[model samples]
Target: MNDQYQALYQTFRWLVPTQFNIAEACCHRWASSSPDARRIAIYYEDESGNREVWTFARLAEAANQLANGLVKMGVGRGDRVGVVLGQRPETVVAHMAIYSVGGVVLPLSAQFGPEALESRLCDSETRVAIVDHASSANLLAVSDNCPALQQIIGIGFADERVLPWRSLLARQPNEFKAVQTRSADPAILLYSSDASGAPKGALLPHSVLIGNLPGFVASQDWFPKPADVFWSPADWASTGGIMGALLPTLYFGHPIVGTRGRFSVERAFELLERYQVTNTFLAPSVVKMMMKAVPEPRHRYQLALRSIMSSGESVGETVFEWCQSALGVTPNEMFGQTEMNYVVGNSNKRWPARPGSMGRPYPGHNVAVLNEDGVPAAAGETGEIAVNRQDAHGYPDPVMFLGYWRNEAATQAKFKGDWCLTGDLASVDGDGYFWHAGRADDVFKSAGHRIGPGEIESCLIGHPAVANAAVVPKPDTERGALVKAYVVLTPEFAHRDRNDILENLQEHVRERLAPYEYPKEIEFVDELPMTTNGKIQRGVLRLREEERAQAPAANTDVGAPLVAPAQQPET
Candidate 1:
């Protein structure tokens, strides 16, 4: 732990009073600070480069109107409101309005299918849903199943039954007195599909917004001030997007640029340059896409990016090298999940990052690598990474989730006394830096040795020819399971001779890892399945492998690519 951050962490609790509301604290307070304040709240743009701007006053007024409108529709405090929208100005307004009226906001991803949408709506017992035209049909399909859902407000289009957003807000007053709520009141419900194999809702309290401040302050690579511009390619529905990009930046009264429509790498670069964005957060996959989309970006655009933060998945060495050369700064890797915001990360401003490590625990967060007996693990010993629910002095980690919504048993299973298990495996070094060893469930046994896919996947991704890689266990009668690799090669290496490439990659892994840890089988694919949050869906891959194993005349190699080794033409 860095001693320098102790003072800041201690002072963070006083920032939010006991009776607090997220909207009143983050929005109304700034808008009403002065009569002539023209502080820009949002700088938005569509796919074609058209721009839209919102001042703090304009934002608060719009949110107030919506809040009042919801009240008129019989929605009030404690009711769950679902927000199914994209990263647009309306999305921000919806979030603020929901909280202003004291309604618990359930953020749904725009990419959710009809079944997924139905499952969450029914589970949360949502009374109202705010959606854009793109997601309107999905919500409508599941409305019948969700008996509690009474109203569906459409952003762009509306039917006889569905209400129009702009028309409804126009009828309501532009002023609303926010409901007073305690810091422990529920604020947001994030649907997370953790190791349990099913979606579970993590209920976050209003204090969570303030709880994240310590991590934000401790994780800054460039130390964002009140005036810096913030933008991110991550979806707002993801925990990192809301905590890292939207909430913290907004709390500081900084202007943020929201992306709309499809995310083109060229447009992203344009936004960074046009907005003169000083700070930004992106998932590692987005960084890789940008690297592929613009090979020599430094020569094409003048980027004023002061710091870059990445999370959602483990970042590899290749991406780090690409960032330093292309963006002129090292991308700070942040680690956390929906259950907890950011607990560990590299803050270059305070402490220099140990390359490829997860960095130290943020101030006020008691993070440690623990063994099976619930004791702290020694340096270089692999164990579960956990955060103490409360410090030795009885200071609770405010950033943690209140509990898994409506699932008391699941919540209880996640903790051991004061330590809350993160379900991730890692090792602490003598210098206090943590190294990721993948999820505990992702670790499989092969030949009496526990193998983590993360270490192997990271090693494969470090190869210059490989664009991405995922490792899974293939059923083996002798070893119980053998390592099988799914690889996506870069464009430059895609058309090369497969035999040579496979041999070279196998040799590469063999040299870096143990003899048995090397992938016994390699299958090249065009792309891998990914979740809404940009994480590779290994669950889907594992299921496919199981189905293939049970197929008629099933080859020992599961889900082998249709294209054979000789099918590749020499390039």
Candidate 2:
């Protein structure tokens, strides 16, 4: 609502052309117009401490060569290409090449299991896949099941059916004519899990990249410059990791720090100190993990971090307070969904952030809290978060998703009228800042009282003894469902198994929230189930609880290690 915000939005709206291609605009244009030939585009570090860097000219050439190779291999405009590699130089190059050739990108997360990978590969009808040793076996397992999949390009691994990365690059020309794409042409396919327990693909277009630029540029308190190094622990396959972090950072031509393997707290600290990362977008869970690992991190590491923005989950006030004092900057929290990224958030340049609020809606976005009838809810009334399809002049919101790929019915259900339902429960305050309650599915009722788990979970995590927390409804015969918490305690508190720990935590929530919202039963665990994007998988926890109830003999007080394989704490 400030002059600076209005100027930023107006500038971007005028600059972005009606037709766009991410690879061309972010890569080739820079390579041609400016002195970006030697500028580093990406700074990559493997888990073993090995490092590599790529420049804009080098990136452009690599992407061009790969695009030529894809064309030679029978790939054409609109073809689907899958990328299933870890965080490496090739991951970025593969994305660039796919976009250059006008092929839709299918970013298959390395964290996906065999069945999940197969489901996506088939659903997207991906013609080709690029993988490394870590994901080759999984790709091979599902290759035959994906009838449309014709080729596998290996980054490091080699086999009869696999094409070598170097060989393919060597055979192709280093000059490729960039394909022309309309603003609405599908460019990327990212799958997000829904209530049906199946992953639904959100097909995004070329305009999405340009549409995202304004919000990100305006949302950072200390806006990232070309020299700033950006990094994120979240999987690049997810919408948050791609549109929210990777592409937005790339738009500024800033160097991105790429990571592979598990997210080690020690390594994260090392990277921060070594790279002097000025701007970053991380999940709140990752920051909390750092605080739990080190009591006072401010005095421990010398960090040059200027701005820390978090999305994919609600950031608690406790995390914000710690960040302000420890990191020397109050973290900016972004509120968005997988379908539409970066809808609202705080940026000191635009407005002072209010603690516990999702900030005001970005200048160009028409967002509101809507009731069931699709009308904007009154201030303080919680309702489904929605975005208007068009503004007053009838220009469509470019950041909105095209639809759920291959699921027309699901796509139709996502829109109620002019507003696109986000399925998130929120309320707009008198100041126009939105306060997130919880997801519609995540909200539950207990004894005639509607309860949002986010409120209780935030209170539990605020306690010094608790490290990570998740709240779910436990089946109760008398009161439909009772609140239950699954928690991971800090190291100091983990050693003590006294009953008072549970009692104190229960009291902690009761004092901070309504009586009916307090957790009725608390379960301690080493870890909670999380998605690749660092969101707590409450559905999985709910399923596990239901299974335990149906068992012949179940432990009433459950406490055990629940870590998933290939799982690491990420933001």
**Per-candidate clash tally:** 0, 0
Q: Report the Cα lDDT for residue 40, model 1.
A: 87
| Candidate 1 stretches greater than 4 Å from native | 1-16, 442-556, 559-571
List the global CA lDDT of all models. 0.78, 0.78
lDDT by residue for model 2 (35-54), tens: 77777888998867788889
**Where does candidate 2 clash, by residue pair?**
none
Q: Residue-wise lDDT of candidate 1 within 1-571, one digit each (tens)?
A: 3534445434433244678788877788889977524788889887666789988899999999999999998888888999988688888888899999889989887866565677788989999999988787777877888889999999988688699998989999998998988988899999865332346889998988877776676565645564589898767776877888888888878888888787778888988988989888876667877888997887989888878887655557877888888888787877776777788888766666666888777766778999989999999999999988764346776778999989999999889987889888999998778899766666565533345677678778889989988888776544556888899999999899888988998888875554566889888887776654556666666666676767747663533442222222222
Off by over 4 Å in 2: 1-15, 442-571
Candidate 1 to truth, TM: 0.78
- Root-mean-square deviation per candidate: 11.8, 11.7
